[model samples]
Target: MSDKKIITVFCATGAQGGAVARALSKDPDLHVRAVTRDVNTQKADKLKSLGVELVQCNTSNPASVRDALSGADGCFIVTHTDFGKQNSFEMEVHEGRQIADACKAMRVGSVVFSTQRSSRVLGLQTRHMDAKAEIETYMHDLDLPLTCVMVPCYYEQFMGLFKPEKIDNNKYILEIPMGTTPMHLIALDDMGVVVRQIFNNWQTFIDKTIGICGDVLTIRDVAAILTQVLRPKTFADKPLTVNDYRNKKDFPGVSDWANLFTFRMRVDQIFNIHHTKMIHPQMKSFEEWARENADTLHNVL
Candidate 1:
């Protein structure tokens, strides 16, 4: 029998949880209990092959969560508010509380909850961010060891939302809001590395709320880098006005995102790049992420 501390990772097949599950599964000091609603999927199969124990658990079901947390020494909890029909803020908060309640009951030693920076800081109410803020409060009131990680915009957003399009010949356009204001971004994979660091240094992170960002750059800066990577292809940064973003029909959650971006611009001083870099030195810059995913970036457009 292997003697390793069990770490229950919820959403084991999705982005956040999958990253943690993959990272922890490689560690000799911990065992990963990968929880997913379905176990027959390809991602779950791949994780199982890596010696990760698969546990079927739905965040909506408290009993399932309790079963997954049983005998686990630690947990990495994350609730999704973007999935189809799961976008309800109430639903997200309910699921989060269920997970936290289970964690408290299990007496888990270490927990790193994936949350977003407070919406209250900007004096606005964003459903997704507000849900996380509520969950953070619930977790804080619990007696269990916990740490909250607030992530900024994802670096991968460029692959879809800001994908460069060929306008004419080699000229391309990457459109987004925030004309020159720096936007913070983080690699989805880097979240796993940071969570691992938190678990390894549990005492240092207790009750502390930390925000992680891979890079801070304006859309123009990002366009410049994309031009260099996809050479012979010059790109232009097209600024989308807040009014336009709020009314953009093609995008769902336009109002929420509009509020978020507006608030981000208002409180630009809070997402300190220097301090975030100090915590996760391995964080990648936009250029680094661009170069690594060059082929994929090119294919998107």
Candidate 2:
């Protein structure tokens, strides 16, 4: 029997979990067990090609969660709110609790859970954020050896939800609801780096709540960086208020996001950029990330 440590990664086909799986797969001392709902997908195949073990799992089912976590020395978890689905918040919380319970039953040495600040803690209502917070609390109640890593806004949002709207004349407007507060941002891949370090030194992170960030910049600063990197395509930050943002009917979760932005503005130090840099020295700044993803940005534009 191999003596290498086993690390199970849930949602291994998705962005956050995939990053952790890829990073941990490279370590000679740890064996990566990737869990997904389906193991036949192209993404799962890629992980399989990396010599990672793939297990089919349904987070809602306690039996599946336990089976996947069995014999795991450590695990990385990221549960989605599944917005637009019915009862997303309850479903998310349920899945999280089920996983946490299984981790305890299996006696996993370490569990790294990606979570967010609870807007409800500040008397605000953002269901997705609060759901993660509730899960973090549940894990605490379970008394599992856990490391709660809170991630800020993803830098990758520029490619999708937060993409600037083009109005005409090659000019675009970025509409983020932060008036003057610097928004914390991090690349999903960078999360993998941080989580790997945590697993490498698991004993120190037990029962710790760590907020990780790569860069902190205002919406205007983000626009400036986009303009500088993707020159010839000017981007401007629109002075949008939370009220105005919530009123937008183009997509779902607008109000929740509005409340989240309000909470971030009012609350300070949700994420720690300095400490995150100490963990992963090569974390990317907004400008650096913009430069690196310029080609993709141009394609999207």
Candidate 3:
């Protein structure tokens, strides 16, 4: 029985939350309060078996989030905005706000928000990222102990995007159309490792916005890595033009997403020299991710 502080984590059933909660669960220095909308889900049951205190909560509801955070010292706040939500942007922003308010009112040691990497400036076309930008600002204004983790596109998302490449050569290509601008990709597994450290050392990080990325790769660089593992393949650089990204986007978020990826409306240096110096400087490369994700390579392709 190692004595550690209890930390409540929101969205514990989903990607960011699950990673954060799972990481915290393994640490002897921290206790995890895993929250979920469905307490009976396998994920929740699994967390319970691992000694996580399960809290049923929804971010959209302040009362639920507050109840989840009521007895905890800290929390990890993240939201899932489905593609087809009637009010996707509002839903995410409101959820974040509710989490922040609960953290402040409850006097939690800190609130770590899950945000996206975008411009240091503002007016990103993507509703989700822009919503994060807004929520981050509000979190700061409240003057509570906080750390905002800014995530880039997940390395996992690439697998979901170009399935054809996965099917043909058993190799998936990384195809973000910045022409080798080094799109930083993050592995979902690695995210938990980094955030676990933050929760363990809460005092050193306050009022900080850190860019979190496990790997960096361009369209071609990733393809090369895939070729090595899968063999004799070229990852296509299939980036849509500004017009196409805005007009021909697969979903309703085309214009919003195009605003950042296509037009570069908000490219920022949150991961600049100084920012990296503050946090752990270790960043994963595409090759490292490919090797670690080898288990999925055969099946994904």
Candidate 4:
């Protein structure tokens, strides 16, 4: 039998997984295996160039996951979170459990799951957020080295949040439910790098849940940054009350989202204050994110 060790990563074509896989691919120690729904994607080719062993593994298929995890030392699992597209939460949790089972059955050394940041203190009642909690439970019962990373809402979403009245207009509005309460947001590109770093040193981080964030921000704070970075514009908080927000057509998972914001609204000591100290990490700020994603911000505004 070959003595080589592989680190299999799911969501290899998307943002978080692709970033982590690419970082792992650059490491000479571990053999990197990347899974993609479509092997012909630009990201797949990018991974191929980086010397990643590309495989077509759908997370929804247990057989595929087993094959992907075959002989792997570690796995980075991040499921698709867009429930609006295909009712994704159920499928993501189902596949996550499959991966967890494979990790135990295969006796893989480590499993690092990219999860959302929500209150473990205030018990979650919604489906998608609760899925992570359940998956974390399953991972706990497993004999493998398990780590959960609580990634905050990506500041990249602010491009959408600060969308102008029209594309060309300079006016910007940040749509946050909470009234001027700050949020702990991470930059997606930076998060990818941070997650990769965590996976690289899984020994130091195993069996821990990490809350990762780039900056602590409020809608007002974000608006000020956007105004300074993009153009002088006002930040308008969309007037959707809790009841009205839950009744909207687009908010299929409003309850889940509400629980998170409502929950975060109370955490007094900010994320980086306590979270950064514990994690011993410094991440990118909103200005850095805007500069990196200038085109996205410009088009959004």
- Report lDDT per candidate: 0.82, 0.90, 0.71, 0.71
List, residue by residue over 141-198, the lDDT tens digit for candidate 3.
9987888787766667656653424435443444354664666667776678778778
Compared with the true structure, the alpha-carbon lDDT of candidate 2 equals: 0.90
Model 3 residue runs over 4 Å out of place are 117-124, 162-175, 232-234, 246-249, 263-266, 272-283
Residue-wise C-alpha lDDT for candidate 2, range 90-201, written one tens digit per residue: 9999999999999999999899999988888688878889999899999999988889999888899988889899998779999998988899999988988899999998
Write out the backbone clash pairs for model 2: none
For all predicted structures, in order, the TM-scores are: 0.92, 0.96, 0.86, 0.84
After best superposition, candidate 3 residue 152: deviation in angstroms? 1.0
Q: Could you tell me which residue pairs clash in candidate 3? A: 119-266, 125-256, 126-256, 214-284
User: Local error of candidate 1 at 262, Å?
Assistant: 1.1
Ten-residue region with minimum lDDT total, candidate 1: 80-89
lDDT of 2 at 121: 67
Please give the ranking of all candidate structures by lDDT, highest first, separated by commas.
2, 1, 3, 4
Q: Looking at candidate 2, what is the lDDT of residue 58? A: 88
lDDT of 1 by residue, 1-301 (tens): 1688899999889878998898888788888999999999999999999899999887787888999999988899888776245457888899999999999987899988988766677677677778888898888887668898887887787776556667898898866778788888888777788888888888989888787878888889888898999888788887888778667635556666777778788775455567667767877888888889988877776
Top of the candidates by lDDT: 2
lDDT of 4 at 46: 87
